[model samples]
Target: MKQILIAEDEPDIQELLCAYLEDAGYRTTVAGDGAQALAVFGGQPFDLVLLDLMLPGIDGFGVCEVIRRQSQVPILMLTALDGEESQLRGFGLDIDDYVTKPFSMPVLLEKIRVILRRRGLAGPESRLHYRDLSLDLDTREVLLAGRPLELTAREFELLHTFLAAPGRVFTREMLLARLWGYDFYGDERVVDSHIKNLRHKLGRNYIETVRGVGYRAAKADR
Candidate 1:
């Protein structure tokens, strides 16, 4: 069974989330603080994480940064703060998604399902392929033209996002939001720089520039 970790402080919210997740046929673990969350995460393997932004010991962003350094586990941040800054900060920390505090249980469950589906963990088949490019979501491996391509964590994420839905136009902001997380205050040029580097290493033709729009993967030949 897929395990989901919920790092939330509020007992009421935690109970609600646990009940919903359990109903969805998932194994659930709860941590009331960031410290305990980290401990639980270190001790066992979890398929997904539902993280709360506010905590007693360590803040959610700090926990996210630390966990990201050690693992690529998908994180969905829950916050009562609805400002763009908080959302962006969570994203910058590599959070997979963000949910506002006054959220509905059904919506939260749907978001969890969507994230897992996108990561290929909730589906029966966990592999995605397009043309000569292939990604193993579970193992975090990428291959091109029958050969493995060495990619950094960010590069892998960028490529994964693009390949998830080929031919889709993703603006720099969108890409940054998905790859860098929401609270990134850095230059938008970072996206261009990464694309440039990715193109140089992967192949110039692998990612196509849409000029005023953004970047996209080349369409597969039918």
Candidate 2:
């Protein structure tokens, strides 16, 4: 499992992030301030860091600077500072990514996924398998029942998302922000359309509709 260090001062947001990240299969440690964050970071290894810029004591930039001087662990800034200057400063510090407050959890999670994958901290050349279906992340290929399955780019991504975490319900909004960019202004039904096509090609049993919620990969075959 990937280890993530979360440095934030807000209790509610810290708890929420811990729950979500743990549910997504990551091991996490929390730091309520920049000083504690640095202390914990020095005590152990971490695959990534979720930093809050407004952290009490030392602040995110200081903590980041301290860490950068020693290691290049990927750092993602989660802050209320959305201004270009703040963002530029974060980039100047070599943060892997920056996310402002009121951000989409799915989008943030996707950003973490991308950063880890890029750094080889996430499973490199990983293959996701659910029963007879397999997705080769490196090759961007999907196979069903040991046979090559052809899919559109969108369809493949949709399936990969599902298989990445079986039984995790993904709301249409979450899927939209994930597959399409967060700024996509298209209708939510576009997800339904792509899912419909994906089901038709990959077999309807592989994905399940969660009534009023959304969709999930059918539970792993027992």
Candidate 3:
């Protein structure tokens, strides 16, 4: 998952931002002030930073300026200020985007999505990562703990669907429809066979049977 640093002082907004970002399948770290943000920035590699302009200590512009001096990490300024000067200044500081307060959370999510995509972190060739497993869509390859995996077409598609939605149960009927299509009048038992084969190839415990439900790619213990 892509990790983001959210530098917003207000506890309410900080909580709200963290909740939304995490719900969107991102790892988030929040800084209550600009200095904390800078500290966190220096300590770790982050995919992006959401900066609040009106912050205690250094302020967002200063943080952006300081970060710009060392790295080209994407920064989006979040502020209640909506003046041309503020926007121009943020842009001048090389901030990727700017958003005023009372912003829609969904819009913020979309902006982050676009920014990450542009940065090639979530683009077409971007690899999907879960645990030590990786799926390269562009190359149609699978890597388990950095080792290459040779999978059949059916197994590949099945594992692909499961990996796409870790922890989400996929019913036999749904799998049949998705993998074999409506025209495949064969027995649903094939789903179990494929799953068994896939599990054998991928570590056996990588997939979990939901007992009465169906199957899901077990969520990795992060």
Best by TM-score: 2
lDDT of 3 at 23: 48
Scored against the true structure, residue 214 in model 2 reaches a CA lDDT of 100
User: Compared with the true structure, what per-residue lDDT tens digits does model 2 show for residues 1-222?
Assistant: 899999999886786677567756788999999999999999999999999999998899999999999999999999998999999999999999999986766567778889998897753336778889988765768889999999887787788778767778989977776667545688999999999898899774788899999999887653
Query: TM-score-based ranking, best first?
Result: 2, 3, 1
Candidate 1 residue pairs in clash (backbone atoms < 3 Å): 88-182, 88-183, 89-183, 91-181, 91-182
Which segments of candidate 2 are over 4 A away from where they belong? Answer: 8-25, 30-36, 39-43, 52-58, 76-125, 180-186, 219-222
TM-score of each: 0.55, 0.67, 0.57
Q: Quote the lDDT for 98 in model 2.
A: 98
Q: Which one wins on lDDT?
A: 2
TM-score of 3: 0.57
Candidate 3, 105-182: lDDT as tens digits: 645766887888777777222467878888775466899989999998778767766776677787887677566642
lDDT for each candidate structure: 0.80, 0.85, 0.82
Error of 1 at 120 (Å): 1.2
Clashes of 3: 0
Q: What is the lDDT of candidate 1?
A: 0.80
Q: So what's the TM-score on candidate 1?
A: 0.55
